[model samples]
Target: MDPVYHIPALLNETIQGLAIKPDGVYVDVTFGGGGHSRAILTQMSAAGRNGSGKLYSFDQDADSLRNKIDDNRWHFVHSNFRYLSQWMDYYGEQQIDGLLADLGVSFHHFDEAERGFSFRFDGPLDMRMNQQAGRTAAEIVNTYDEEALARVLYIYGELKNSRAIARKLISARQQRPIDTTGRLAELLSGQKKELTCVFQALRIEVNDELGALREMLVTARDLLRPGGRIAILTYHSLEDRIVKNFLRAGNIEGTIEKDFYGNILTPFRLIEKGLSAGEEEVNRNPRARSAKLRVAEKIG
Candidate 1:
């Protein structure tokens, strides 16, 4: 694939936020399009004159591996970042010096109509991040109970009209199964404002994205050595909230109660308050508008 797709412009800032050390091992948990991975490699290689540093890249999409560049120092793992810890153990590695994650979906998934990740395309309701994963968007939309569907939209997608949309879907699927992405889109045409939310809910349920992200973060907390930095770029508020809470309180609950001595306890210390793309970057890449970058270093 050509490099026409634009990734987050804060790649260099994210790598530098890691405080990259020569000969240090790094991990790019989401190797989408390899933009961030390529930048990290360039900096790490320049730092280490002998080029002995290593980079471990992980992606659940098998198609991403096809675009892997021929590099001796980098190892690509064809699995979800949720299993970062397992892969680290398999590679006989204890911890990494830095970890970078660009949590946004790759352009390929959205640009490809058949993937059913975009609302612009009329295609099958198939939004599986990993092809091998069970349950497609069609299955959830066609089979889930009205109440469950409403919950999915309300929580994951934060749709205000979730109940109405879920009821409409259930009624529509009763007459005819919601098979294609366009079919569902047509059925919910009355609720056009909630179209993105409905689809986002279906995609989240089909792929269990939130659950996977939580697992990956927990595993990362364990895999990163002390002072090791973890940078996460989240596109949606749901993901950003999780990242923020986790980094600030060392847990997703975001509770920061003080101890008897009035001292707070946290596992991760904030590096920069937040990292965001500049106005110039947003102008060049509109997709960067929704991105929220957060960086933290492992402390406890």
Candidate 2:
């Protein structure tokens, strides 16, 4: 595994939270650097249940293919995690023992300038996680109407000055297309946080991150066997809130349903509630500071 590709956050905590069953099936939906996936594979025993335990790692980014595992029990699916159910069905897996998703951008993408995931470097404004499909960040910046652009920034980035930023982008593109990361970054000059928000908003828009996340969460809820766990590491509040709500209520809307006894009905029993990394880990890898791991086990 490439250590530089990504340093899995809360690695020990997440693996322990899953409570791996040696003869049970597992899935790693975000196999960025194969760190977590490799860890999961280590816990499974090949001799158990006639060597039936398996792991299916999903990654939409073709770049991740380079880090594929060579283990016979490992299967790499080159597709978005939103298609989790379909792919699981294709593999004849009706129920999974555990599922994991580490939802942060890999260091490789941010460090590589041409990928356009970060504003620290100059490159084309292309932020598609799956480079083969979807509109580039530049296309959204240049083509989205002011209101649409502002909505993306406000909803995804949580930027208070989304309207102003959108207006400025609209005005700037009128002179010439906003095509490169440097040019876009120059136009968005402001407090570092705001600049990060703008770039984050564009990347989320380009990849439909939230929408895909919701779909995958729902599918995972349905596909997990009773007592099976799902562990997710979220980097931002937007995705974190969605995950927290779904795990608590067993639905994306987070509505709690109570029985005649006033007991709440939920498919999952919460295991970890937005647990963050320790200061020691954060000091070692600053990028882990924002990661929150939420784990839940399906109620039998």
Candidate 3:
């Protein structure tokens, strides 16, 4: 396994929450570095059920193919997690015992300057997770109207000065296209926190992270069998809130419904409500600091 690719956050907690069955099916939607997937494989194999257990790992980034598992029981799906239902159907899997999604950007992405996932590095403003397709961060910065850019920053990054940042980005791009991370970083340079938010906003926009996340969450909910578990590790508030609400209400809107008897109706029973990584783990992996783990079990 590539240690630098990604360090799975709350590894033990997520696995424990999953409570893997010996011969049950599982899905790891974000197979970055295969840390969490490997852990799940370990638990599944420890039961000594031979090859009865099956694990399907999904990743859109072709780069993740480098960390693929060799076990016969482990199948790697080279597709976005949003297509979870489609791929599961293709594989003839109707239900899953558990699903795990770690939404943090891989360490490989941020550390590799050429990926343009971090403002700390000077590179082209290309932040697409799937390098083969989709709009680049440079395109958004160069083409988006001020209001659209500001909306992305405000909604995705929660930047309070989104309008001002968008205006500045527009002005800077007018002089010359903001085609590289260094130029965009220089134009938007400010407090470390704001810079982080700006880059985060752009990356989210480039990848449509929130939209894909919502789609995956819904598919995961439907794919889980009764008593099956779904564990998600979200790095930012926007995605975290969506996970929290979806798990709580068993729907994306988070609207609680009641039966005629006045009992609230939801398809899931929340197991872990925004559990953060422990201090020991955070000390070893600072990226785990922002991670919040949420687990829920499907109710019959």
Candidate 4:
């Protein structure tokens, strides 16, 4: 099956908010399923761009390239977005007109049980976005010390039962290696609803997702031309919190302040407040229920 990601109705709104210029450049840092990328391409080429405009798309997952559409205007960088600045330098582009990061997991990953991104499936516990990357979720769960495992669960999963889960996992693995996603899930069966939390934590740790995201945000801020806008769509509190604080205060923490004259101090000026999916859209795609879209402009 083709990956079934829920396209947010706010796609047009967020793209429009970017105020795309016909001849200007843009970046889609996460080109999952090419949904948002397709929308951005349409708007960029609406006036017959003739491939003059550029869209630098990034995705570490090679599977993503399989869905890549042929277009001169778009250049897919088969690397992590954490290397955003380096890639732009390689392309000889100094700044961009806008950036869009829809930080959602592709339905392709979840649906492909073999990839092991979902607890619903019984595949090997491999959640590496790029299979070529070292270490899988199974390795982390079965190898990390109890304290470290607890930290991953607590910090990434936000699971109140993190300690319990970690203890259980460590104990269960002593009998036999927790090799498969199903085995791990079964080992923590008491978690039930919290199973999602455990899997999410493992995926985050295995991928170093938050660290990569932080790097991307900083690089994106530096990459934006003066007045360029960025739209970020996040699915969880951890990611949303980072995006929220970064956009509003230009820091991961909300401690940054305006100067004495009440002028804002952030590198990014808020274009609008946070946005969530409307009822109709959420009903259509339950996956969008937790999405939060935030847009900001780089102030010179």
Candidate 5:
């Protein structure tokens, strides 16, 4: 079963992190369902249109673009947020006041069975976030070497039985291609957690999700103005850890380098540590249960 829509997680916290100014520029890198983008727009003043303020949003999925807010103050870019800074540069914009990113798969993907994001429905194993670009999940399941498959499952899905799962997938595909979500799910089916984990591992690899995230965060660091804030909502440990390290130490490794006077050299200061979705929000949107919000502001 899938949620009705991509209810933006930690909506108030995410928007508040932006600290919207009437005459400021902001960006929502994951404009799924336009939930967060619409909220950002609401906070901006009408007089802050072209001259004073503007909102730019980017989403890799073309389906999400249909939900674009039709306001002069809003601009939608159809590209992965990994190129966030590039797009900003293309727009001739130097820097932005804040950036918001709600990471992980959008609810609409899982809701639409044909997208192959969930095991609840049988469909093509096509887990590409940008449906038109990149390899499908089916390709990797059928083509990746046993060890490579195990690595993806272990690292991304955090599956302890990744080797066993990889072996099973390899054996199943030898008879015929494991080409659909139902077939893949059937072969690896055991515990419900394992089912979801395998599917998640496949989706992350099919889209190079982690790679994109790393690039996006690095670019964001370069693009934010001094005092600018970055609010990110992560659904899994892999994402949360990377975001935490980057925010605190200015790198994915989270290594703190000291300057001449032994001052830790980092790009941003933490505004809020990981804040879980309140019980109320989690009750309304089960997906919010795993959400953890982390915010940081640029530091000199």
Candidate 6:
């Protein structure tokens, strides 16, 4: 199998954010295309003058297994990053030195038509990142109640006309199931924003992306040793906001509590302000335009 490629957004920035150390343990939660993972491994390799270190990468997508790194210092886990803690424990690692997560969908997901992640393609409306488990997008479009669909669209996609779009989908699906991405996109042809929102909402619902992200963030914070680091790249505002708040508040709900010393009780300290891909990278990869990178360190 050929190497699957994902031009990692802010590659150098993410590596610098992790502050990789020789002989330290690290985890790459996304592992899409393995570009970022490869770079981290290169920095940690014994021949690179860094002490030998171990790196573990997680990706539920079966397609990603094709790019598995065969080095002794690296390990790949075929699971969602939300289970980061569980898997790390299984490997006898209670805490790690650093963690990196590239949130949201990957390039391969959009480029491959049969995956149905992109509205431009004519394929079954299946948007399962872990293709083997869980329901597909088609199921939600065809069976979810209109109100439920509207909620997903409104919350995940941040679309104001979600109710109207849900009504339209309900009416169309009554005659027949919304079986394909093309048909759904066609129904939304006149409204470009509606089309993008509906597809985005359905993908999030199918994958429970936000839920997984919340789980991953809390687990990552718990699994990191004090002074350990985290770098997250989020492709959409919804994911970005969650990452931002989690790092700021130490919890998904964004509640801040203070310790006796009056310091914020957050589990992590912000490393830097929010950042995005520079102009050159955005020009080369348009998708990087929406990427938001946030880095933080586990608090004392």
TM-score of each: 0.94, 0.97, 0.97, 0.95, 0.96, 0.95
* lDDT tens digits by residue: candidate 4, 8-36: 44677688788888778999998877888
Ranking by lDDT: 2, 3, 5, 6, 4, 1
Which has the greatest lDDT?
Answer: 2
Report the poorest 10 consecutive residues by lDDT, candidate 6. 43-52
TM-score of model number 4: 0.95
- In candidate 2, what residue range of length 10 has the lowest lDDT sum? 44-53
Error of 3 at 211 (Å): 0.9
Q: Write the per-residue lDDT of candidate 2 for residues 113-200, one digit (tens) a residue.
A: 9999888999999998899999999999999999999999999899998999999999999999999999998887756888899988
Q: lDDT of each structure?
A: 0.83, 0.92, 0.91, 0.84, 0.88, 0.88
Could you give candidate 6's per-residue lDDT for residues 131-217 as a string of tens digits? 999999998888889889889989988888889889999999989898998999888864777777778888989999989999999
lDDT of 3 at 185: 77
- Per-residue lDDT of 41 in model 1: 81
What are the runs in model 2 whose C-alpha is more than 4 Å off? Answer: 1-3, 46-50
Clashes of 2: 0
- Please give the lDDT score at residue 280 for candidate 2: 100
lDDT of 2: 0.92
Candidate 1 ranges beyond 4 A from true positions: 1-6, 47-50, 190-192, 257-259
Model 1 worst lDDT run, 10 consecutive residues: 1-10
lDDT of 3 at 289: 95
